[model samples]
Target: MRLMRIGEPGHERPVLASPEGRHHDLSSVTADIDGAFLAALADDPGLVPEPERLPETDIAGHRIGPPVARPSALLCIGQNYAAHAAESGAAPPEQPILFYKSPNTIVGPYDDVLIPRGSKKTDWEVELAVVIGRRASYLDSPADAAAHIAGYAVSNDVSERAFQLEESGGQWSKGKSCATFNPLGPVLVTADEAGDPQGMRLRSYVNGEPRQDSGTADMIFGVAHLVHHLSQYLVLEPGDIINTGTPQGVALSGRFPYLGDGDVMELEISGLGGQRSVCRPA
Candidate 1:
């Protein structure tokens, strides 16, 4: 199922997309798409009313918000793609390297990306974001990670290279936690609907010019392994989002210019939908 939230920012209503590509209001079933709703849907998808007889919403007329309500935690993995590691002048690590984005950074997919004050190295990263469905802690194996995931969504891990590299005191989150940094979804597809999480094609374009083009297959640490590894040290709760990192091709590599006012970014993942953001001065 492709679930979404539509309306103006902070006032979105939950919705479900039908097989025929129509949308139905899910407000009658749930107030918002969040941990509780995900847990309930796991038990009975029928908990969401059928769209056939319901009044269809004009999706194009409304703004699409992040598929889920504010997640409890916005976690990220760094250098999970070997090419990205190489571009950043690092070798692929044996284990997943983790980071955090303040939950406030979450924003709707099509929203404007703010270029923070005095910034000159804003960058783009197209990544596959994992949405957790069940609480998991200290899992025994990679196989168990599947049951804990609710679905996948396209994510742009927007970054500020200067703040991240030179001024961060070596902490990457310094550049990653700016407001509007993480543009999450146009839709959150169910795990059953998302197919193989590690095989999707991901791409990013700036002002209609290609920037990043790669596949999840390039990931050094796949989704299941990251989840399993993370569970060993931290509790993965329902509604927590994990950005699994990006493949190379960002401004930080010095191949493309950093984003500036009015520059637009477009990101997409094969089955997870896409995102577009226009840069604006903070």
Candidate 2:
């Protein structure tokens, strides 16, 4: 099922995409697409009722809220892609490089991405995000990691490189936690709905010009390996999000120009759907 949260920002409601490709109200079953609701929906499909028809609202009329309403933690991996690491002048990580983005930074799909105050070198990163369904600990193998996954979504790991590196002295999270930095959603596609997350083709564009374009096949640390590695350090809970990492087409890559005000971004991964956002001055 392609589950989503719709409506206005704070008043968003739990909704499902009907077979007819329309949004069907699921408010009768749940309030929002947060942790507990997702965990319950993951366990019991019967709790949600089948709809004969979708709502009459325009598909484009509604705001696309974050696939999950509130995540316990927003974990991100740095340089998980070899090409991206090399482009940034860093060696491919010997271990999974981890960082945290506050949940407050998350915004809905199609929302405007803020350029962050005092920021001159803001950039975009299109990443494939993994949403955890079951609690995970020290996993024994990469094969077992897939079972813990609930679904997948498209995420923009927006960055302020100057603050991230030069100003902070170190630590990527400093530049990563600015407000409205993470634009997520369109939908949270269940693992069954998003077959082989590792094999999908992913692409991104800035102001209608292509910037980042690559496939999950290019990832240095695949999804299952990331899950297996991350669980060794922290307990993975349902609703925890891990941005697997972006490909090598960001502004930092120096192949394309960085973003400024009025720049729009569009990103898509095969079968998972597409998401677009506009960049504006903070």
In TM-score terms, which candidate is top? 1
State every prediction's TM-score relative to the real structure.
0.97, 0.95
- Give the least accurate 10-residue stretch of model 2, judged by summed lDDT: 50-59
| Residue 127, candidate 1: C-alpha displacement in angstroms | 0.4
The numbered model that scores best in lDDT is: 1
Expressed as tens digits, the lDDT of each residue in 99-217 for candidate 1 is: 99998898999999999999999999999999998889999999999989999999989999899989999799999999999999989999999999988999999999998899999
* Per-prediction CA RMSD (Å): 1.1, 1.7
lDDT, model 1 = 0.92
Candidate 1, superposed: residue stretches over 4 Å from native? none
